[model samples]
Target: MARLVAVTAVLGLLLAGCVDPHTWPEDQDDIVNGPLEVRTHWQAFTLEQPLQINDEGRQRLHLVLDGEQYESNDLHDPKDYVNQFNPRRVDGVLIEPDIILVGDNGNEVRVHGTGSLGVRTGRLILAFGTHHGDFEDFLSRPPAIPDDIEHFEALRIRSNEPFTIEALHWSVDRHPDLHRCGRRCTWLERWLMGE
Candidate 1:
């Protein structure tokens, strides 16, 4: 009898992780319809667009973190940077991201971006970009930089699909005297672009 009871308890614990729950936290429901259904469908998109600086004197540059298409030269000429997410496709639209992650934040931050791609039943779309500030700052107050560079992760979601990392990049020129985050940042960009 004692052996049977122990076996049953162990079996129950094993089954818990495999069970797919239909519900999610209320805050997460908006982007993803539900927990189990949304996180599994999550995927990463990569763009071929190169990084270019803007002429507004802001010293800003645009990066393709994840998406379907690439921006054209005409757009780059004027420093428009409007098609940040490559918005030409009819199926999946590239969206501007609202949420960004930087470094290890003690806890993982959730996605809170404002735009959406017309993702269907089994797909989730993610867009990527970069800026010259602590990626964590977007979520809360920026953190003190111990090193010149850091890598950040972003997540995107849709109904019942798995939570997916939409984009990953390092902020190279975040500090005043610092120029670039060095080879690690460059390597991350190359890896993301599948170069």
Candidate 2:
């Protein structure tokens, strides 16, 4: 059964990204012109379904932390130098509400950002670029994520789909999974997956 299942997963070709996938679905009405500026975001998501981000969702930065409502100032304050998760800027769209993606293969990833869930082609990808710091900084020392802010425990994205927060990176160490080049996976996610 195990071998059969593994073969099935491979046959599925569980590719998680697309090239030039429309930022918004063709059916979705155009809301902005010439590349909508999605600024002040930190994390991002690969979505499966549609959801809403109302005024409150937007104001709250679209994150639910510690089961409590979390909000983002989107102020991009200098004081937030220690917190990479703080309000930052990225160019993307929120096709839906935030939810983590857990593949059938036990690979998982999460994206935290200004606010949004994503979708494109047949797959959904909501991406907000993270400030991994300059090339030198990344190789030497990735920017700090503030000791005060809780990691895995703090992020709680309500979702109906099966999910996995326990595995920090995707795929078990025994086997390697696909690397999502586009919005499907962020640099941080890829790094974590390797670890």
Candidate 3:
């Protein structure tokens, strides 16, 4: 009975630590390596559509998801947009600001870009643009993408403000449209076809 009680107590404490009490627009405490919550507002693909395997070769698709974070405190205006932080070069020293992405599985991907980045003091708008590569082995195992859907619910970005690009269950699929040339095209295809 004592052992059972101790185990239960430990489990309870561990679970408590996992809970994040800070809510968006209210919590902006950490500016550097701090947790910022980002909600997915929109997403797009670099290629017009999912790359189809042609000539028995491998295919890859580039995905982009845009997210945003808000600061609704006296320190920041609730209605203002928090831009991403930008690094500067001082005295020939190159300072690079970085943001990290944390997936639902605890895997992390680093975000690198200067788009929508802001200064730490005067700016609050942080724009999150994340890219992922999806590779398909045409010869061995072709991607069985159902109706051309891409699932990215397990992806999130970590920065001064935590950004959730999409919900853990988010999925995106491409549907054929008449005007889109009966199939989506990418720069690769354009180059290959010499168009």
Candidate 4:
């Protein structure tokens, strides 16, 4: 009886260790690097400065989602005519930016533009829980752009579970000397001119 009890206690301890929180798989890195599809739409409000022009002599903004590429000629550009419109301002704050994604049971997610920059931008991804109410909880809040985010190409969403990015809305501080020529103009110019 004594020997059997000792064996049972050892088994219990091992089982408890196996269930330890530290033993749980860390999902952060996987979520950040996992395969994802993100679709974003944006509307611009305050253009405090002149529009930055590309090598083609057209204004351009590099828009990216889950490795997909897009460009905008103007801040007011939209995916479709019906969906595209100028941003509306409330109390001097622009409130027209939104994003939606199609995923797992057509789950729709929306993001509001918080802020942005020439290097990186910030947004708030708001998740609405589903019928089960299991997934309705808020995911990770948006973090300030890290120093490594040098450009839009480096932007990524870090999450644990499977997540679909629905939309992004934000304004950029105007690129400087947009009227200038050569590689110095805008990020688009640098790519186009291969400078």
Best by lDDT: 1
**Of 3 and 4, the candidate ranking higher by TM-score:** 3
Candidate 1 lDDT over residue span 2-43, tens digit each: 998976575445434433323211111122222222233444
Q: What is the C-alpha RMSD of each candidate to the true structure, in Å?
A: 20.1, 17.9, 22.0, 23.6
Model 2 C-alpha lDDT per residue in residues 6-90, reported as the tens digit of each score: 7556433433332333332222121111222222343333333222221111111222221111222223432342332332222
- Model 4, 1-195: lDDT tens digits are 999897657544433332323322221112122123432333222222222212221111222223122212113343332222213222222222233322223333332222222212332222211111122222222222233322221122322222343233222222222322343344544443234
2 versus 4: better TM-score goes to: 2
Give the residue spans of candidate 3 off by over 4 A. 1-95, 117-195
Tell me the whole-model lDDT of each prediction, alpha carbons only.
Answer: 0.29, 0.28, 0.28, 0.28
Position 17, candidate 2: lDDT: 35
Predicted structure 2: lDDT: 0.28
Deviation (Å) of 19 in candidate 2: 10
- lDDT digits (tens) for residues 1-195 of candidate 3: 999897657544433443333321221222222132332332222221222222111121111222223221223322222222222222222223244433333444444332332333433333323322221221232333333223212232323422322211111112111112113455433343334
Ranking by TM-score: 1, 3, 2, 4
TM-score of each: 0.24, 0.22, 0.23, 0.18
Clashes of 3: 18
Provide the lDDT at 118 for model 2. Answer: 29
